[model samples]
Target: MSEILTITTDEVVPDREAVFEHQGIPAGRAVAAEIEALCTAAMEVFRQAAAPAGVLAEISKADFATLYKGDGQNEDATPVDEIYPRAKHLALFAVTVGEEVSRRIADGFKSKDFVDACMLDSVASASAERAVEIVQQRFLERATARSPAATKGEHRRLAGVPTGETPVPQFSSRAEKILDISSTGGDRRSPVDGVLAYSPGYCGWDISGQRKLFEFLKPETVGISLGESCLMQPLKSVSGVFIIGPKAIHLFDNCYSFCGRCTTHNCRDRIRALDAGG
Candidate 1:
């Protein structure tokens, strides 16, 4: 079952460095005063307009049987084949920075204010990503706090608006205390070491897989919608599976057919960062 994850604009605001990086402004370079001023203004607009929200559903292996293996159309081995089978826990999630930012970006373009539009676009993108990171971090804390003997059907809560039909799950005192300590940077070691999100359209997971992902997640409760091409509306939205387990499960060499033409190889950086944090 899925529950609404609490999110707020303040929590999802992108840092200046991330916003500048997304806008292709090199780090530590001498930026023009005007550019700096624009970034400040853009951030204000984003903070005012952005409505960050998300939904999370803890799932098991049987939840995605078809996605685990293809339907006979293609037989390419994907990273998830290595990751999911070994995951100690898994969840599907989606988050968005709201449509107002998208509308403002379009308005900027329509008004031929490319500079303002570009900065806001970068901020929105960064905010979307940051929201995901926040959700992932919270999930990490929850996973770490949970007792080893906790039942699979055990209910969990992430405060704020409860999304699905079910009532919000109450927090156990021990779990709540653990959450408080961990959120403040306590020194608790988690049974599960790491978590990384994998969306369709990457790592050989077909983009069309969004169909099933949406079926399970139903993120529209948070105002995100999937279109014909599996692209999410709000333009600044992200959806994917959270793979939780030891760092080893997430490791994979870039050897798929899609890898040769790929330029970024971002998965490498993500895995390395996870390892470093561990």
Candidate 2:
């Protein structure tokens, strides 16, 4: 189906606070105990102060030959293939944490409570990230089951398990069964095949890109809107496109490699932390 597909779900707001591996909260990488205490307290407040905000999404893949086909993929094409090689499909998607979190932050700012504001920020970030995960999980399950990957035969690393690996298995009865099923032609289809997610104002994709995403996703169906500056209105919200092919791993792992493309240096640390995250 060439038409865009939409997904919606009520995600249980993740019950945790955002933490950085090298944050200088009280000081550089403050004691985990102290941070945990702070996070626990903040999360307690957030639990009541906020409610589960869901996710909204739109996903579609277009022919690479059009707006995104790299260079040599087509003989008439130019040098883009060198920059982004072997990209078979462009998967565009946008997901957002809902409006209630925004209400919490606005209320915090109104009272001039920085601590509360920061806690809310952590919760909002967690919620937004969760929103994307929820949407992706749903989309992938739906997409792969009905996608070409399922019907069209493609070479994928088939399910396999080696025998006599003491570290993993000691050639037990299960190992014999495993080796038997480890054939050359097996399907490992996934909607998130080497996905390279690009959010508006993120990963070198300019904030201005949100207009295109918004127009495509119509995120307003789930109460998401963009501000005049192209930032998603919920503040904690995120939007992006995905490149789902093997060549996209590098961008998916470190999107900031294209940092030079964006002029806004405001969120470098935050973006870096997210990229470095496991």
Candidate 3:
């Protein structure tokens, strides 16, 4: 079964910079007032048109062994025993702003509404960003409040998001949650203070790897689908495997966020500085 959740999509609060970035506006033409006005109007469309949604599924530890092995994850160990070393429980997630965002994008292009298309593009990206954060926040709260306290479990990163803008050699999580190299070693542990996301594609699992994720997720319950190529259909959707446990933490040098690549200040959570934008 899937657990559905809500997230804010009110007033996109247009970030002119993000709009320009999305529009591929040249740096030389950035100061154009005409473009700015267009972006502002697009933001209004997002507020009125976008509807963000979040859904999650609970996978017990019992199926871990069979799941990884059958997925052809086998390399050295029996696959399952190799990838999923420890801990309990798994949460599969998918978040989207629905087809309305795309419909708006199509309508914009058809009517010569460049700003509408571009800003709606920004909204699609922005909605996916916020929806996932809300879902992760909710997951962490639940994982931490349980009887044993989620923080106590040593984290074992089987899969999740890249820790930062720069790629690390190992397990990925939010940069702040990532530890220094000195802490790197066997079974690294940290307080289960937050939830981290991972997908098949992140840790080298490609479209083929997603089969296990979808089979286990049964995303249809939440209106998500893996296309013939394994990409999410809505195009604006986000999917990942997440869990809360100390061992889930991965070590790295100077952990950075993927947001480091973005120069836009449009996102509410946009890390203004390149340094530790947690």
Candidate 4:
């Protein structure tokens, strides 16, 4: 079963700078009064129409194996292959700002209101991202709460573990099962202490993986759906697993065969942000 995550408009107010950047305008650039008015209007629509909500389900390490496949056998090893094995816990999640915002954006475009359509689209996109970020933070908080020591200010120091082998924060018998299932069983170095969300179609993980992910998550209860092309509907929705492991597991150079054809190296920025504790 999955848990429903409720969020408010205040939690995911679209960032003004992000909206401008999404619309191809640099942040802080002088804007015409009319454009500013349109931006304000877009924000109002987002505030009224947005219904940010999410659903997340914790999966056993065993289930993640089949869900992490690519197009075919012998496919290139993706970043997920390297990073997921080290995870102490994994949760599949999906978040969206909801369908009303999407409907309004479509209505704008249908009436040939390109400026309004673009503005609303940008705001909706930013709002959806913010919703996803909020969900991730909440999940991390719940994870921390599960660790009794973390609640008492002993987050960094494990009780009986040796100095170099300090287990990951919130380590449990479940983690031992994860270690046994993973190839890293015999290695006693503790799991890493960071949480990061990763999605399909990035870092060599095939977009086709979305089918399996959606099957397990069944985000339809939260009004998110997957398309035949493996794209999530509502266009602004984000879906993926929150991999809880060491920071080093997520570090990787984009040297895969697929990297040469890629245009956006967004993973570099994401990894850097993770390292910076963002």
Residue 1 in candidate 3 has what lDDT? 66
Tens-digit lDDT track of model 3 for 24-130: 76555646676677667767777777767777887676664445444564333221232334444467788877777778888878999775686678756756766
Give the candidates in order of TM-score, highest first.
Answer: 1, 4, 3, 2
Q: State which candidate, 1 or 4, has the greater TM-score.
A: 1
TM-score for each prediction? 0.81, 0.57, 0.63, 0.80
User: Residues 1-278, candidate 1, lDDT per residue (tens digit)?
Assistant: 88898899999898888899997877887888898899999999998899899999888887765654533333277788767876778899999999999999999999999999999999999999999999998887788678352221121222221333233233223332222212324464442356899887787887778878888889999999999988999899999888876554565668877888789899877866763452
List per-prediction Cα lDDT, in the order shown: 0.76, 0.45, 0.55, 0.74
RMSD from true fold, candidate 1: 11.3
Q: Count the clashes in each prediction.
A: 0, 3, 15, 1
lDDT at position 183, candidate 4: 27
- Model 3, TM vs. native: 0.63
Model 4 agreement with the true structure over 14-55: per-residue lDDT tens digits: 778888888888778988889889999999988999888899
Better of 1 and 3 by TM-score: 1
lDDT, candidate 1, at 274:
68
lDDT of 4: 0.74
Best by TM-score: 1
- In model 2, the runs with Cα more than 4 Å from the true position are 1-12, 15-17, 20-35, 49-92, 147-192, 247-278
- Point out the worst 10-residue segment of candidate 3 by lDDT: 269-278
